[model samples]
Target: MCGRFALFTPVSELTNKVGAVMPEREIHPRYNVAPGTWVASIRQASEDSAPTLEEMWWGFRPSWAKGKGTQPINARVETVATNNYFKSAFAKHRCLVLADGWYEWIKNSSPKQPHYLCRRDREPLYFAAVYAERDDGGLGCAILTEQARGSAADVHDRMPLILDDDSLEHWLAPDLTHKETIHSMVRHIDAGLVEHWSVSTAVNKPSEGQGDELINPL
Candidate 1:
């Protein structure tokens, strides 16, 4: 699950890459973006308009949830289409969760090492996500995950559904709701396209602010 991640890429760079308008507010660089925080997302404005950037809560809360428990931050791709909590969003609220990289802890090791996972070419990782608005006007989003493969499998059993440039448009199409067509667009990115390395354990703690030290190799 994508419990922790980082997105320190400049706002201007993101605007250029995704063709979305810059967020009006100044966005500070983040190194350890934890769950429950606001995250940057890209989604189509309408059926015929360009995609736009939005800052949404990093958890999914359905309108009927009544705000009483933990919201889900990651939804399994295998069951997202049929699960009650995620089906509607899965069908209509698709989005791109922007990040430069994410951190995952290796299991069965004393003082488990945290690893940074990202594209081998150092490009941004556009995670597949879905969003929904709560009754109180709050916006929430959840990252989609598929079974882990390659080196990522050694760290955890699951990883975010990272989308390529070719998949972005279809993944964010506002009117595409056919289950099979949508699911087909959410295929796994080849493991060879990604790389991972051990990083400082400081990421184990949740805090805000940017620092290269957080992602520095250990």
Candidate 2:
């Protein structure tokens, strides 16, 4: 699961690649992103509108399910299409969680060995996600996860659904609501293109969350 990750890349640099109207709020860089905190997400106001960058709560709890008292940070891809809590968002509110990389732990380690995963070239990453409006009016989001692949499988059995650059437009197309079309047209970044390294356990502590050292290989 993508419980903790980082996204210090400037929004100014992402405009070209993400094809979104940048947010007006000054976004500070974050080295250790945790659930419950707001993070940058690329989405559309409507099917006819251009994509835009906005701050979104990291936990997802649809307004209709507010009484359930749950805010999940990740949703399993396998059940996302049929699960009542996620099917609507999966079909209509699809979105992208912007990040530089993510973290995973080896459960058997004395103190789990945390590893940072990112592109070999260190470019920005777009994670498949879905969002909903909370009763309080906040936009909450949940990252999509599937069986781990490539080196990510070595650290954990599940990993965030990383999207291929070419599929960004298709994934955001509002008219394409059927899961069948999404599955056939959208694609995940090749697992082989992603890489990881052992990092300071500082990432394990959200309080020591800022600065580049947290991602520096130990």
Candidate 3:
């Protein structure tokens, strides 16, 4: 699951790569972005609307479920499209979490080791996601995850559903609500292109906050 990530790519580079308008506020490079914080994302309000960069809470819960349980940060791709809790947002509120890379801990490892995962080319990536309005009126989102593949499998049983560029616009199309249509139109980033390496465990603590040192190879 994508519990933590980093988005240090400059706002100008993100706008150029994502083809979304830059937010009025500048985005600071954050190396250890934890849950419960507002994060930059790419979203389309409607078919006719241009995609825009906006901040959204990293945790998600249906309005009715708010304050009822823990906010979920990851939504399994398999059930997200049909789960009553997620179907509505999955249908119309699909979005992309802008990230440079993410950190994952090796399951059950002694002394627990964490690793940094990113594109082999070190280019930015977008995580498939859906958002809903919170009781307080802010948009909160959950990253979609699928069974792990490639090197990510060694770290955990699941990994964020990283979308390929061709699927970005289609993934945001509110009109395409059919699950099959979505499956056929979107594709995950090729597994071979994603790689990971052992990193400092400082990421286990969110208070370590933003620092390139968090991602440095151990």
Candidate 4:
């Protein structure tokens, strides 16, 4: 699961990289983004094919959620299509979660160590996610997860469902609602597209926010 991530790229760079128009909000750089915080995501509107980038709360709360509980931070690809919390969004509210990289903890005999993972060539990546809007106009999204592949499996059992530029259409296409098409679009990202490294455990705390300390090697 993608519990923590980074998005230090500037808004202008992100717009050009994702080929989406940015909103007017004063965007700040974030080197250690955690769940429950607002982050940028790209989604298409029905009237126009151009992608619109907007900020959305990281955790996902289904419209049917009752009382306060842990909103799902990640949705398993294996069960997303059938799970009540994710089915509706999985079928229709697909989105691309923009990020420079993500963090995962590796458990060992000692305390867990945090590792940063990004595209091998240092290019930006977009995680395939599903989102829903509440009546109050708040937005929430769930990062889709699949079985870990390549070197990533050494650190964790699951990884976020990442999409490539070529697969962007299939993922963002609103008309392709068939279950088969959706499942096909949810496959693991190519291993060659990513790189990883160890970083300081300062990111273990959500309030640490963005700083060089978080990415500094211990």
Candidate 5:
């Protein structure tokens, strides 16, 4: 699961990359964005124009799950297509959780080591996500996860479903309704396209790690 990730790219730059409008308010770069906090997401515009960037809560509390003990931050891709909690969103509320990179912990060793994973070419990483409007008039989202493959499995058993450029538009296609067709469009990052290195353990503490230094390789 993508418990923590970073997005230090400037809003202006993100707008250019996703063809979305910038938020009216300033967005400070966050090197460690965690669950229960606001995060940037890209969704199709209401007017059928370029997608728009939105600030949504990171945890997904289904409209029917009010007052539940713990909201979900990640949904399993294998079950999402049919799970009642996520199937509706999977059918209609698709989105992209924008990130420059994410953190995964290698737990085999004592004092698990943290790793920063991102595109080898350094482009933005777009995590496949689904969102729902809450009863309180706010949007919340959960990232999708699949069994880790290749080198990524060495760090963790699951990883966010990172989308490639070819899949972005298909993932966010607003009116698409054929479940099998949508499932066919899901894409995973080529293992060779990604790279990771050990990062500071300070990332273990969300408050202290939301800075550039947290991403520096150890």
Candidate 6:
């Protein structure tokens, strides 16, 4: 599951990259973004419309789930289409989560090692996700997860559903309705498109914010 990640790209750069207008708030760089925090997401205005960027909470909780428990941070792709928690969002509230990279923990006899995963060329990535709005007008999102591949598999069984530039239009296109078309769009990113390295566990804490020290090798 994509419980933690990073996004250091400036709002201007993110707007240019996604071809979407930015929100009014100033977004600070986050090297240790955790669940329950607000993050950037791109969503279509309506079925068959251009995408627009917005800030949303990282966890998803439908109105019926109020006073239940912790909101889900990740939604399993295998069950998203049929699961009650994700079906509505899957069909109508799809979104793109912008990130420079993400952190995954590798299990070992010792403490789990945190690995930073990003585009091999250091470009930003877009994770396919779904979201819902609360009765109070607050928004929440859940990162989609599928079986990991390539180097990321070494750390965990599942990874965020990432999209390529070519697929961005198709993924964001709201008119597409075939389940097969949607399933086909969900895929592990090319191994060559990403690089991974161990980083200090300082990122285990989200309050650290951005710093050279978080990316430093332990």
- On TM-score, the stronger of 1 and 3 is 3
Q: Go through the candidates in order and give each one's C-alpha lDDT.
A: 0.85, 0.89, 0.89, 0.79, 0.85, 0.80
RMSD of 3: 1.3
- Cα displacement (Å) at residue 215, model 4: 2.4
Q: In candidate 4, what are the lDDT values of residues 81-183, reduced to their tens digit?
A: 8887788888788888888889989877156789888887877878989898754578899898888887788788888888777777677777767778777
Per-residue lDDT of model 6, residues 1-218, tens digit only: 89898888876776675577777787888888889889988888676456788898998887667747458999998898789878878887788888999999887625667989888888888898888886457889999988887888888888898887767766666775555788786555687686788998777777765685776666
**Which candidate model has the greater TM-score, 1 or 2?**
2
RMSD of each: 1.7, 1.1, 1.3, 2.1, 1.7, 2.0
What is the Å distance of residue 85 in model 1 from its true position?
Answer: 0.4
Residues 28-130, model 1: lDDT tens digits: 8888899988998888757877888889899899767788645999999889889989899988889888899999998876687899998888888889998
Candidate 5, 1-218: lDDT as tens digits: 89999998776775675577776888889998999999999888444777888998998876677757357999999998798888888888888898999999998765778999888899888899999887677999999999987777878989999987778888888877678998887677787887889988889889775769998989
| lDDT per residue as tens, model 2, 1-218 | 88998999897786567579986688988989999999899887687799988889999998898548689999998999899899999899989899999999888886778999999988888999999999889899999999999988988999999998899888878888899999999899988988999998777889975898988988
TM-scores of all predicted structures: 0.93, 0.96, 0.96, 0.90, 0.93, 0.90
lDDT of 6 at 83: 91
Tens-digit lDDT track of model 3 for 26-138: 88999998999999988888878888989999999767886685689999999999988899999889999989999999888767889999999998989999999888888
Off by over 4 Å in 1: none
Candidates 2 and 4 compared by lDDT, better number: 2
Candidate 5: TM-score? 0.93
| Strongest candidate by TM-score | 2
Error of 6 at 128 (Å): 0.5
Q: Which ten residues in a row have the lowest lDDT in candidate 4?
A: 61-70
